[model samples]
Structure formats: C-alpha cells, structure tokens
Target chain A: MDQALDLSGNKMTDLGNGHAVIEYGSPWGRPIARWVPSWGEEKREVIERMRKHLVQRFGEDRGLRMAENSRNMIIFPNLVINDIMAITIRTFQPEAADRMTVNAWALGSRDEDPDLRKLRLFNFLEFLGPGGFATPDDQEALENCQRGYRNAREAAWNDISKGMPRVGPPKNDDEEQMRCFWREWRRRMSAAA
Target chain B: MNADAHLARAATASGQCTRAQVEEFLYEEAALLDEWRVEDWFAMFAEGATYEVPPTGDGDELDPAKSLFYIADDYVRLRERVARLLKKDAHSEYPRSRLRHIVSNVRITGFAAGIADVTCNFITYRTKRGVVDTYYGQHFYRIDCSVSPWKIKSKRSVLDMDQLYAGKLTIII
Candidate 1:
C-alpha cells in the first residue's frame, strides 16, 4: 500500500513524464485452469475464429507469432509514450500449468501530443467531474463519448488492417464496436498524418 | 431548509472519523475483494448502500456523462447483482474469473458518524481463458461507521473500461 502511494505521488510530481507504475504480487498466483483441456473441438472452433479474425484485421501468422509484443500495445495504444523499453511475460507451455505474469516498462519524454492530452483530460473531467453528478446529463455525455471512442477504435484496427489476419467476423455488438472504433481511429490518424 | 439541515448535520457528523480509521476500513474492503469472498464483500455495505459501476468512454477522466452501465440509487439492485454471481446459472461467473485488485489513492473527502464519502483509485486484473484483462476505476463509497462498524452506505465503481469486453460484471470491482 505504501509503495502504491509513493508511486502515485511520483506520478503526480512528475506529471506528464510520470508513469503510473503498479505491481501486483501474490503467493496465490495460479492458473484458473490447470490445463486448458478445452483446447479440443469446441476450443479449436473459438481459436480458429479468433485467429481468422485477428489475421484479417492485423495480418499473416494471425496471433501465433507476434501476439506477445502487440497484445498490450495494440489494446492500449496511448500507454506507449515512448518505444516500449521492455516487456517480460512468464508463461507455461500447457497454457494453464501456472499463472502468467506480464510486466512492461516504457520510457519516453513527457511530450504527450498536446491535442491528445487535451482530448484525454477533457474526457476525464467530463465523466469524473461533479458535473456528471446529474444522472441524465452524465448518461448522455457518456453515450456520446462511447460512440466516438467506438469509432476511433475501429479506425485504429483499420490502420493495421492490411497486415491483419482473417478470422471470423465480429459476432456481437462488443466486437463490432471495437472494430468500428479502430476503423475510425485509423481514418483520423491517416488524415492527420 | 430540510436539505440545509441535513447538510449541516452531515458536515458536523463527518468530522468525527479519524483519517487512519477511514483508511483501515477501505483497506479491509480491498482485502475482502481481493480474497473473492463475495458474501463478506456485500456485508461491507450499509443497509441501503448502493453499488454502482458507471461506464466512462475512452478511459478518459474528462467525460463521464456517456457511461454505458449506470445503477442508480438502489441497494437491492446491487444485491441482485451479487445474487446472480452466486448462482451457478451466471455464465459470466462460470469459470469463475480470478481477480487481483490493487487499490490506491485513498482520500477522505468527507465524513460523519453514520455517513462518510470517500474516493479510491483501483486497477483490477481478471484472468480467464488463458487471457488477462485489465480494468481501471475510481471507487466512490459512502460509509457509516456509527451504524455498525463501518457499513458502506453506497458504492459507485466508475470504470474506465465502460465498453467492457466481458458479458457482465460477475466479480465485484
């Protein structure tokens, strides 16, 4: 707890350059399943679907080869301020033999693009601020931002669409939302670039 | 006049709790959540305490009005949520996701004997299907130590991942 406090303080003190460093330690670390025995017909179906879709969006080897480095970076593009200094992940061969722990350290100058930072901060204050206390008003603003974010996310995915492997298309609203978000995000980034 | 009287009384009442005690209460709650003791976790709340998880977009701190999930003003609603988790029928809890909650930034924004307002920053990691997902949220808890050794009067978990990939919030955030 004290360590977390100290880290937070450091983040606040350093402001833009600071990284919100967090460490979760537990002797109880263990896999939810001792073995993903489900990697059979049913599991294979899901995996194939995931692989095809990922390939279509990201490209080639699907996720078998490049998943480790790209998973976090792809999911959260903003987190990478500078080139990722390092990412270490511990995994077991059988998939569920033991718990896997992933640790990443990023180093970058605090020059968070001003427009990006402004957008981020504005989004934050809008939701967490006292103005959001009004339930209806809060809900409306929240929905609008979500709509924008979904568009941005699909745009992002579309940026890497060329290299993306082909998997099954999104089956539900959540996956569709992500796809749309990345697609729009890519469009905006290209326009700016 | 009624609201004014309530506010005055609340302000006066909140002044009594020591900062350390408030911190301790929060830590205990975190411990319970980390342990995955759902029933015990529910007991931490006051009788009418509400547990809310508001969805914010882009994980941005500025805009909150467009939250995806909003549980407004109901303790029983939270109870129903917990009940669903406890049942075997809840697919979201099926494999029973494992969670590690890291809570920080505990600050006492206000306090009173039977009422207190507090804020905490938390990051939770949930693992399932050989995949790990992360979530960040600020917990807004209203407590009443005077009522019964610090029961939560209300709790709002405002998650940055409002467009959650999962089907439902089976585990307490």
Candidate 2:
C-alpha cells in the first residue's frame, strides 16, 4: 500500500474556498511503469504514436507536460475531476445520511486522432467507470466501510490523521486531503449554525 | 417476405454463413459464459478482435474511439481481463457468480466476403450472495467465418437499460 501510494506521487494543495487539488504524476515526471506491464507491443506503439502526436500538435514542453502529468482536483463539496490516464468528471449527490448516488462522465478532446482517441477510451474503461477493473473494487471497499459504519455509535470517531506531523508536502496516502475537505465542511456548518 | 426469409436470402446471397450456424455459434458462446469457461470463450476471438460495451442509452452507432464506453477492450486487454477473472485473487469474482445467459432473436443481418454481421438480444442473470442482477442488451457482432470454426472479429453489446441496477456491473455482460 505504501509503495502504491508513493508511486502515485500525489501532492496536495489547498486552493481556498473549499476547493483543493492533488497533482498526481510519478516523481520527476517518470511514467508509472508498473501499471503498463500487461501492455503488449501494439499498445506501447500506440502510446509512442500519441506521444509524437502530442509533441507535434502542441509544442515540446507543453505537450510533454500534458502527456506525462495527471491531476485530481475537487471543486468544494462533491465534484471531482480526475485527469489521469484518461479524464473523468465525477459528481456525487447525497440523498440521505447513508446513501448517495454518483455520476461520472469521461471527458476527451475533440478532433483527437482516431487511434489516440481509442487509446484514451480504452484507458478510461480499464480503470474508471462502473464496470472498470478498478472502480468495482473501489465501490466494494466503500460499501464495506459503510457497513462497518453501522457500529459508528460505539466506535465513535474515524481517524483522518496520516502524515499530520510532516513538515513538507503530503503524500498520496496521507489523510491531509480529507482533512482539508473536512476543515472547510466544519467552517461552513459552523457558519450555518 | 418475412424478416427471417429476407435474412436467409441475404445470407445465401453472401454465401458465407447461414442463420442457423450463427445461432449455434452464439448459443455455444453463451453456454461457455454461463458455465464460467472464460478462457475457452476468450479463445473464440480472432487475432485482432475487440469487445466493447458502450454506456447505457448510447446508440449503437457511437464510435468507442470518440465516446466513453463501459467496457472497451482490445485483444491484449481482453486477454488480461480473462486472466484476471480466472485468478483466485479476483476479489469481485473469487467465488464466481452463477450466471445464466439467454440469447434470442438471432439474425444474420449481413454477410460479405468472410465476415458475417449478426445481431441478437440477450438477457443475462447473475446471481451472487443471494442477489440477482439482470442485464438485457442487444449484441452486434462481426464474425469471421472463413475458418472452420468462426471467430469473433468484434462484439459490441449495447445495453438497453437507463442505469446500472446495483450501481456496479462487476460481472462480465
């Protein structure tokens, strides 16, 4: 778990007004090679082609930046934009204290190269979305947590203290991002009260 | 002429595969999935085959390249998916759900050269942990029948539902 979090290289930044951004790219802009072991020659070829296309379409520096880095940003309460291997815009609506519904959409650039677009779509389906390999597990984890919350009255508080003593930026696995959100949430609730 | 007769005529005109043959192939494929013989099912794909499921409510014409899809898998990724599912560690399917695949309304819409364009309706029920999920959809397929046993060149399953019933489609459709 620590290795995975470290590999994600998430650095959190509190963008006042209840918004926050977590920039996630491997340290030094290196590709997360571990994630691509299953990719064959054809898939690697597509990545190379897309890299060239990006470089040609948008100058060298910006194109490399676009191809390399990914970001996960939250807009206040519920909206999140995960611009990772593929871009996904997600929002959740809380229907009750225990139930909520989430809506997610994949975002892609218009007029993208056909092959690259296919790759982007493939990336989106591989990790994000309801049926993806990753999201189902995430949903399961969340549901498990909710089930455990049934005993919250006895268990009381949930811990959100990771990397709290760090002097510098927070790591991906750190709970600082959640703290940021909760801080804003508390401020708003106190104001309303 | 009725639709079946028209389709039969079209199949004969193309002289590639008959409706009965396509139906038999689809039935066999469905049986493999229902029995959880995923590796065998995976073997039925052509070398460069693609399997796709566009998001619910999206029409069949939406190109997976240009739009989002619930599942879009090329040959390599599809292979990986099969391998993952068969593993004992695939938490979502570790015990493997009981599945029943009902395929109907099979038709050979078009055939040319060695490829047959087939369409069918499917309703798959997945039962796990005492919960049942129903997935109904139309399947559009491009089957390459040049070889003795046909291989799937492309299979696109377009779901007819408005939303996922259980908020998650963990099982393969």
Candidate with the greatest DockQ versus the true structure: 2
Q: Residue by residue across A13-46, what tens digits does model 2's lDDT show?
A: 8888778777666432112111254444665765
lDDT of 2 by residue, B1-173 (tens): 99768866876765857778888999999999988899999999998999988888877998876777788888988988888888876666767889999999988778788899988999999887677889999999999999878899999999999887677776667
lDDT of each: 0.48, 0.78
DockQ for all candidate structures vs. native: 0.02, 0.60
DockQ, computed on Cα atoms, for candidate 1:
0.02
User: Quick one: best lDDT, which candidate?
Assistant: 2
Fnat of each prediction, in sequence: 0.00, 0.80
Worst 10 residues of 1 chain B by lDDT: B59-68
User: Cα RMSD (Å) per model?
Assistant: 22.0, 5.2
| Native contact fraction (fnat) of model 2 | 0.80
Which residue pairs clash within candidate 2? Answer: none
Off by over 4 Å in 2: A1-10, A27-67, A165-167, A190-193, B7-16
lDDT of 1 by residue, A1-193 (tens): 1232221111111112222221222121111111123223443344355455555676543232222121211222233221111122222122232322222222212654443333223222222222212222333344345455566645643222331353543222123333444555667788899
